[model samples]
Target chain A: MAQKPLQFRLNGAEKAVFVEDGANLLDVLRRSVGDLTAKRGCAQGGCGACTVLIDGVPGLSCLTLAETVEGRSVATAGGLPGDGSHPLQEAFMAHFAAQCGFCTPGMLMAATALLESTPHPDRDQVVHALSGNICRCTGYEPIIAAVLEVAGEGGGGRS
Target chain B: MTIHRGRGFASINYPIGMNLGGDPSQALVHSSPDGKFAIALSSIDLGQGMKSVTRQIAAETLGVPVEDVYVDTADSDTGPHCMGSFASRGTHRVGNAVIVAAKEARAIMLEAAAEELEVNADDLETDGRGNIHLRGAPDRSITTGDACQAAQFRHGKTVAGRGIFLIPLSEVEPETGEMTPVSCYAHAALVADVMVDDETGEVTVEQVNSAYEVGRAINPRLVEQQLVGGAWMGLSHALYETTEPRYPDRSHGPVDFSQYTMPGPGDIARHDIAILERPAPDGPFGGKGPGEMCANPIMPAIANAVFNAVGVRVTALPITPEKVLRGLKANGGARPGPRR
Candidate 1:
């Protein structure tokens, strides 16, 4: 397979990479681009650990072919503002939304897309939006609370 | 068009650490020349916040800020030996070892500071801001980094400490098969409320309330996460997960998460947890770990609830719809079978 120069905007920088056809954007970002934030959990779309923002939309990077991302903007957990400045990141830490942090990147990315789309989403909407991401730790309560907190909803409306 | 409601209860307990007598975790604490420190241990974090908890313990003992301490859990060959992370002993076992090591290192740091300040080692105290000063005198102090330089160059002493936590062997009485297997045990009780649809043979757990005695929570948030995650795991085990569904036939076994079912966000129940603090006398900082105890009681509780709802007993793991329907058909959902 011939490799092609796949160029895309990552975080805030424009980057170009040589990727073979059928290579996944996850591998290109992690191996070729040296960004290890996006975890390689399950590799299959089932885990959703490789979720990333493609044009501000959450997509499973593992299932995405590298060539398809050419000229598209991609965002990841590392792209979030440093020092826990992002509302989601601060909310995550404040609410103890992360444990092990293996799934944090994907969860954060998924939540980022959710918050962008539905700023005042209800508990069910948050759950539905985060259905694709799986976290073995923190059970999803704190994660849900963090998202809701960032939404200024005083946490999820769970009784 | 009928939904049967039921409730069930279960109580369980789990040992804190490995039962083996030689289950030991070792830690090595060393100070950097810049007054920062690192703890070398063989215990892997496994995303359970082992690194953070152990770091807090080390910093507390060393009288340093938490930010000044770093934990390196990589390379078991280079780091001290740990009995792996599965035994739920990472926090209790490794934390004790870190306390011992940090205490030793703190003594060395104080001695070095005393040398530079020309003060008695016993009279010096650490202010936790990388500074050492005499009691009742905040104005006169020396930086820990400066003391480290003096210790190495002037006193020719190294600032390091080593520690290990080991449990004594409990001899088993052959007749009764009884032994003190672990130093302490964490206890939990769970109540599961469910609704069963007789027509579809489906079970939906509406809510779960649990009480856990974790001895002590080094980090309350981390404990809650473990409890919540563990309950989810137990729910999956009781209602969804199975290695060999068609038992004795390996052809239809699930090979992946997609094939093997687990409850997603939509299926999760409302979980309410009540933490009971009963300090363990022998535990580190009066803390008995809660790693594995959270998942112990969920299965039996859910199974009991299913039986109460439909008056059918499921004796096997994962009370799947097929099993529920089979149980219902066998007894016609008239009377509950003998409880397991």
Candidate 2:
């Protein structure tokens, strides 16, 4: 294992780091770049806790090779405003969507991709979009309601 | 070839806390010169809103605003002794300790205000808006911050209190194998509606309705979160989750999330919850623990639902499709149980 240099736009800022060959994007982002928001839940892509936006599409960072993200835009939950002013963050707080918050970053990344692509996704669409993400807390109900609230759809009343 | 729909019901009376040895939780309440309160404890939150609910309890007991209170749960070495946060004892046990500590600290705070106002401490009352006032006189008052400052700087008194809650261990009768297990109990009833595909043996949970009698909800939203998430976990354990599908040969246990199966967001059922509050006398603000027991009733309810749908009684966990199919075959096809 030799280490190589990888450069990419992370959260709208150019980030350059040296990563070992076969290293995953999650490890690089967490260990090398010091961005610890993207959690390594399963590390096998089955649990989407390490989800990140690769060029506006949600991808599991644990499954992504570091070098493959070279020169590409990698968006993480850290990309959201730190002031807790992001609409998703506000909605999550208002709806009590997070508990322990280990899966929150990935859920936010996945929802970010969905809202960016389809601004007004329906309840089923939200469920399908978040199907890949797993939350052991909150039962995915409040999370769905939070996203729906941001999309101007009120809680939608139990579908 | 047909999908059979059936409903089943299950109820449970769950104990609140473990009575192993002696279950105890300790809390320390102290105030700064600025009147901001901090509660120190060793109980871990574990994503169940332990800190938030305890803060609410402390604020209520101290007669102060919630925003002025903060909870610090340092490690065991730094904080007070706790029986840990398992057995759903965080709310019932730890909250009682916080209440005692906050009451002691509030007494000292009122005493200091009484000294400054030249009135009897018994005649002073907290307005819960950060002010200590005379019981009958509305205009005669002093801010809690000023009271704290007077207590610390002028009176040279520390506005702090220590509290510990303990349920003495119940001695077991060796001959009878009997013992008092817990202090209080929470009750729940759940009805699961499921669809079983007779041909494929796949079970889909269509809807779930549950009612919980949690001795008073300290925070209703947190209780709701626990109920919803616990039911999902129950459903997962009922139909999908298993580490050893091929038991007795422990060769291929799941090493990752891919092998370990759980219900995804798409597999979630429509759940409706009704919370019934019956305050426990020994509970803090009449609140009991609602963490672990919320998931208990759903597992048996789902198992019963599968039995009602296909007349297959699955005694083992996960109730896998293969087991359902085998049970159906043994019973000579899908024998739907009589509807209740």
Q: Per-residue alpha-carbon lDDT of model 1 for B1-340, expressed as tens digits?
A: 4688888899987888877656788999998888888999989987788998999898888888889999999989899898888868888889899988998888998899988888898998888777889888877788878877777788888788999988867889999999887888889999999988887888999999999998888888888888998898788788888877465578879888777775567778889999998988877787888888788799999999988888988899889888888888898663533343
Candidate 2 DockQ, CA atoms = 0.70
**Candidate 1 colliding pairs:** A100-B47
Which portions of model 1 show Cα errors greater than 4 Å?
A153-159, B116-119, B127-143, B334-340
Q: How far is B242's C-alpha from truth in model 1 (Å)?
A: 2.2
Docking class of 2: medium
- Assess every candidate by TM-score: 0.91, 0.97
- Winning candidate number (DockQ): 2
lDDT of 2 by residue, B1-340 (tens): 9999889899999998988888999999999999999999999988899999999999989988999999999788999999998888999999999998999999999999999999999999887889989999968899999999999999999999899999889989999989988889999999999999999999999999999999989999999999998888888888988888455476777767777886678888999999999999999999997888988899999999999998999999888889999999999999998876
RMSD of 1: 3.5
Return the TM-score for chain B, candidate 2.
Answer: 0.98
For residue B94, what is the lDDT in candidate 2?
A: 97
